[model samples]
Target: MKRYQAVRGGTGDLTKPDVNTRVQDNLYLAVNSKWQKDAVIPADRTEIGVNTAIDMRIEKRMMSDLDKMVSDNKVPAIKNLDKAVTLYKIAKDFAKRNKDGAAPIQADLKKLDALKDFAALNQDANELDEVYGLPFGFEVEADMKNTKVHVLEFAGPGTFLPDTTSYKQEDASKLLAILQKQTVKLLTMAGMSEEKAEKYVAAGLKFDQKLAKVVKSTEEWSDYPATYNPYSLSDFLAKIKSFAMRDFLKELLPALPDKVIVMEPRFLDHFEKLINPDNFDEIKGWMVIKFINGLSSSLSQEFREAGFPFSQALSGQGELIPQERHAYYVANGVFDEVLGIYYGKKYFGEEAKADVTDMIKKMINVYEDRIQNNDWLSENTKKKAIVKLRALVLKIGYPEKEKKIYDLLQVDPAKSLYENEKALSKITTKYAIDKLTKPVDRSVWLMPGNMNNACYDPQRNDITFPAGILQAPFYDLHQSRGQNYGGIGATIAHEISHAFDNNGAKFDEFGNMKNWWTDADFKEFNKRTQAAIDIYDGLSYGPSKLNGKQVVAENIADLGGLTCAIQANKVDKGSMKELFENYARSWAQKQRPEAIKTEIAVDVHAPQPTRVNIPSQCQDEFYETFDVKPSDGMWLDPEKRVRIW
Candidate 1:
């Protein structure tokens, strides 16, 4: 306690804390008030936290390494690191890029202009994405029913706004105006007159509005069952009358399968309606906007500046990120594994990997025990749960089968950044297409080690802990087990619990979308899930409230994760105070009020303050540890508190 106090800037007013401020009552504020008081969210950022801080640190290191790779002639010495350096060097040439203006994408724009009909558009879709990238996406993901094979999937076009619900906002007119102004500016820079640009913006706005009606909102899509509709090619064609589904797939698919997954059937239905000859002008306008927005960072200073205000309005960022930093991020996106391998080799040591791996094993053990002891589930259900838990794949630190996607990458420093990115996109597309014929590789990892986030892929039944997230605030080799358990332990548990969350629970041990639970057991599960939803639905941050129905799966995972971690701590012989305090400290964050509003509306995860306080308040152990009573601001009624694992 003394050590924690000393490290956290000594004790301050524990006895005479502000009651009205609600700081005394909240565990998060009590643990992190000293740091929170001084924390500042960067002007270019929406929010700032331990995660972001660590990412910035890693970015600086990557930038330095890139500089060395380019200037110090270290590229040839390393095996795969040169590809990242090559991409970085090409993008880093700001002067040449600014001078080139929109010339690099001019040929691509000409191709779009020459598209005479829908047939031409279909034929060019794959090629066009390689140049400007597509808002409409296609993928071959693991089949939900038959998990052994990859299935062709079609999804709706990506929105310019943060989410589909943004189109229906009461203040939507204001957002539309911002989009109009930005679109006009971008088109004008792309050689269109201001008058003509306004016309395009009008068409684009109407097109998106029509599409928004049928497109699923982020909240709606979170329901796995809602997006799981499947159809045969003939059946899919019959559902829509406006377009030839078979003809469209001729160019898009190498060999059209009899069966295809319709992720958003409503969107596809409306998209067919929206794709007539009369709508080409509107489609062209939307395509132009997407093209310009996608490559804005790699364009001239004017083009980049033109897109900033709209981005700022969307995300509530005060200023655009620095050009060098922006280029670094672009390199990371294009050459993910190249940078990941370098990052892991440089920053993540063997000791850290070993420690994290051991921690993961412990958490998995705890979850198996949890499932075995759970009273609500039937014996058969529990046995199936244990089977799935045991089969859970763990990928800690980095991938064992090295990702060598950069072998074909060739970037010339003298070429424009847009040209280099376009070239890389073609190679990436080819790589994705190559996977269509291959068997499902269970060892494949979805996330890069350089990313400061963890993920659980229900289809793969796997959890990934990237090297970037394996450090500080989350884990420390020298720190006490209590602190480590509270930091990374909760994160590990959260992801594991995701396997049992609303969406993930649909998939069984073999990663097939088969229910392992009995009808009665599933009914009980729904009741508990509904209770959780009701609790989160009522939570408010100032005037803004949470859409608990949208974020229930994540919230359930959060509670389950924290509970599992706390239980694991009990087994590991750790202090509750240390574990609980560190848990609060891990979620310590601050954001702009505007950012808070955006997050509450669009983000699947709860706001930082909500994340820290809500989980602790719901736990009985939290109350016991802190001696919290009904009179305290953070206290909840015993029956109101919801729990599920």
Candidate 2:
């Protein structure tokens, strides 16, 4: 403790404590106040905090290596990695791109222009799905219930606002207005007259406004298990009156399956009206505008600059990312797995990987003990929970096997970036369609190793800690064990806790959606989950308030992760104070107000401060370490604190 005080904290990307602030009153503020003062939201970024700081570093290292590969025109024997280089050159060739302007997409744009009516749309649906990327929404994934075979899932097309709830707000009109202006400008840039562009924009807005009314709200979407509504193939096809749905499916899928999982039953309820003759003009316009906006970056620099304000308003990003960074990110998205493998091999260390794997085991062990002793659950439920805990696959660092899709990628250097992306989209679409009857490969990772994040996929019943997150603030070999545990240990525990969260609880040990809980225990569990919701509900952050129901699962995980980490610390002796401080510090963030509003509207996670303070207040160990008083700002009355693991 004296050594930490003597240092007065490190500089640049490290959280510096504010000595004047008392830990008893505000843990996040006390830890983040000085760092917040020093932190600047980069011109091209909407936020910069703990995660982004690490992300920027990782990006720098990865991009620098990639930059060298491009410069030297060299690549290792890594299979199909040269395709990424091919794409990088294509995307990075701005001189050719600027000269080509919007010429490459003109013929593609003409396809939308030629859509005269519903019949035309039906004929083109498969081609659009291939080239344009699922115009509405349809995905192939491992069945939530079956957990082995892949299933077809069709969902709603949300509006320009993205979040359906935003349409309810009076302030949403301002955002819509921004969209309207940008859409018109982009259309005009694509060689449409101002009058024609206005007509197109108006029609698109009309469709979007109605679509927003019918689509699910962000809160409703937060319930992962409820989305698994299966419809008989015949029954599903009958819902679509106009668009020759039968032929479209036959072309899109390798074989017409027995079922179609309707992800948005409500959206499907109004499907015919939304996609029919009366609304054909509006629907077509919506498709056109969305296609243009989505691929605007693949066009000239002028087109990208034209679409900036709407992006700026939505995320409060001050300026566009440089073309070099933009090119790298675009290429990176397509070849991330390949790059992730290379990145893990080059940047990630074997020692760190082994250490993190051990920490993950400690967290899982603690969870097993917690479940065995959980007062709320019956023994029957306890036994089932332990089975799931033990079965939870830990994918640390990177995957040993690469995805089969990479084997098929053949990027052509002669083609335009837009053309390459379009061709690749079709290839990706075919790969996904081919998976309908195939068994779910549980070994395949949901997240790549290069991302500075971690995830738990309930369907696969696995947790992945990518190599990108195994660094400072999250994990560092040089940092104190308390800091390491509080940083990545809590994160590991967070992913474990997700297995028992409101959504994950619906799935059983085998990753199948089934109720393993006794009726009474399930009820009690929900009561506690509701309590978790109530605490965060309507809590203010900037101009928006959190929807407790929307963020309940993550909040539960945050609390549970903290609880398990605290217990793990009890077994391994460490500074409880440093654990508490670093736990608070890990969530240190600075976000733009616009970004916060957007996050509140759609994201399942609560604001950063909420992640820190709420979980800290819920922990008894936090009180002991900080000497929190009833009078302290961070203090919560014992009864008001929530806990469930």
Candidate 3:
């Protein structure tokens, strides 16, 4: 143990400890403190830890390849590669952007200015989508109840504030002050006088504040059924009597659907009332602000500098990100799949994908055993659970065939960045419109392989582990089975467990919104889930308490994931001590105080410290491995432990 600790950087060993302040009450700190203390958060970043390190490693590799592409004199033959290279080169040309200034978005501003009244505004709104700064968000998504068909989804406008809860924070005034300053700066850069800019900024803020009032808290949106308000096109027109809903829909979606799903009807109702001619000036100003802000990063240095302080106010970032790194981000966003295909071919090998596939099968086997052995659930529910587990779709690494939807995408080097953005947006819209009438493609991946994240889609009954997350820290091909199982194995389990979590449990094996639970079984399940929520509800980070109900789905997954990993560990060669330590290492992270503040307001996942420690206390194996006595801070009464998997 001593030799391994020395060789592996001694994360879990507690015999000889380093102390800045004595908070070493649990295994998480004992395992992670030294590293966290020694680590430096970058000047441009709010926080830096395990996940950030892995993301930076991926970024470095991608940037290196992109730089090489830029320097190469040979003309690119592949259409997709050429498109990606063109976008990257455009992003890198800061001199052109500086010269163009706000001219690129001037046409958009002119459209807003030309609106004489609400009638003209509504006409423009119908033609404009969210990317074009429409007052409301509009999109087509598969209906949750009827997963086979897509429906138009309308919701309230997004707030500039990080979360709806931010409006109620003590720092709300300070944050808004920063927002106002930046808005004025951008408007002035767009050729408005200082006096006019201030007036516009005030009007925009008033408009946004009113919209924010009707916006549901992030917690409230968790109840899927609550947000699922479906109405016939005529019913919507009558309900929202203030507006020409039919005409708007006809213009926005030329082939208008008979039915539309209003995610939050109350918000829509308020928006309908707020959009009267009386609110024209404020509404127009707000639209202009939204348009310019969206293009701020792609515009001049003045806009970028103006936006930086507001960003710092939100996330505690001290410096702006380097221009090259910003270009990489833009390039990835513009040509995700093209870059993803290249990234997968260059870095993600077939051997690694196969290894992950094998690991997934083993993890599923463990879940099958648990469901079969569960005494609380009925045989009927147990059978359904096992079926769901077996039927779960696993998408490792990247998609088999990268779609060539962007073949017709034309990015002109002579064009401004905002012009390119508008061009790209139109292409994406056409693609989405094309998909609206088609059957749901279960094989399609929602995220690219180069993004360092994994997710489970309950609508599709599938889990995806992107190639970016399949590498070191998360999974090390050269590391011990203990480490791999503890890291990526737990992540896979987290996603799989989501299929049975509070949210995922609502759907059946085929991704239909049908419950397979009997009344008695469902009652028992809710009791268990509520207990888990209670545990998290009592936990706090900084000045904000966790919205336990909001985060319950994720909390359930975290605990169930740890349980699944522990079972998988039994088949591998490692002590409970080594396994638990590796598990702790997987979640190792630190945050700026401000970042923690925002996370408490917005994030669905529990803070990282809570993620590492809470699940450990619930495990009997953890108590046994660490010899956690009743007096230990990590101790949880066996009866109090909430195990929901």
Q: How high is the CA lDDT of each candidate model?
A: 0.77, 0.84, 0.78
- Which portions of model 3 miss their true places by more than 4 Å? 1-24, 74-79, 128-131
Candidate 2 error regions (>4 Å): 1-20, 133-135
Candidate 2 lDDT, 226-272, residue by residue in tens: 89899999999888887688898888788999999998898888888
Ranking by TM-score: 2, 3, 1
Candidate 1, residue 255: Cα displacement in angstroms equals 1.2
For candidate 3, the TM-score is 0.94
Per-residue lDDT for 254-320 in model 3, tens only?
4878887898788877866677788878887787677767778988777888767777888888789
Q: List model 1 lDDT by residue over 336-367, tens digit each.
A: 87678778877899999998989999999999
Residue 618 local lDDT, model 1: 70
Ranking of all predicted structures according to lDDT, beginning with the best and ending with the worst: 2, 3, 1
Give the C-alpha miss distance for residue 216 in model 3, angstroms. Answer: 1.4
Candidate number with greatest lDDT = 2
Pairs of residues at least 3 apart in sequence or in different chains that clash in candidate 2: none
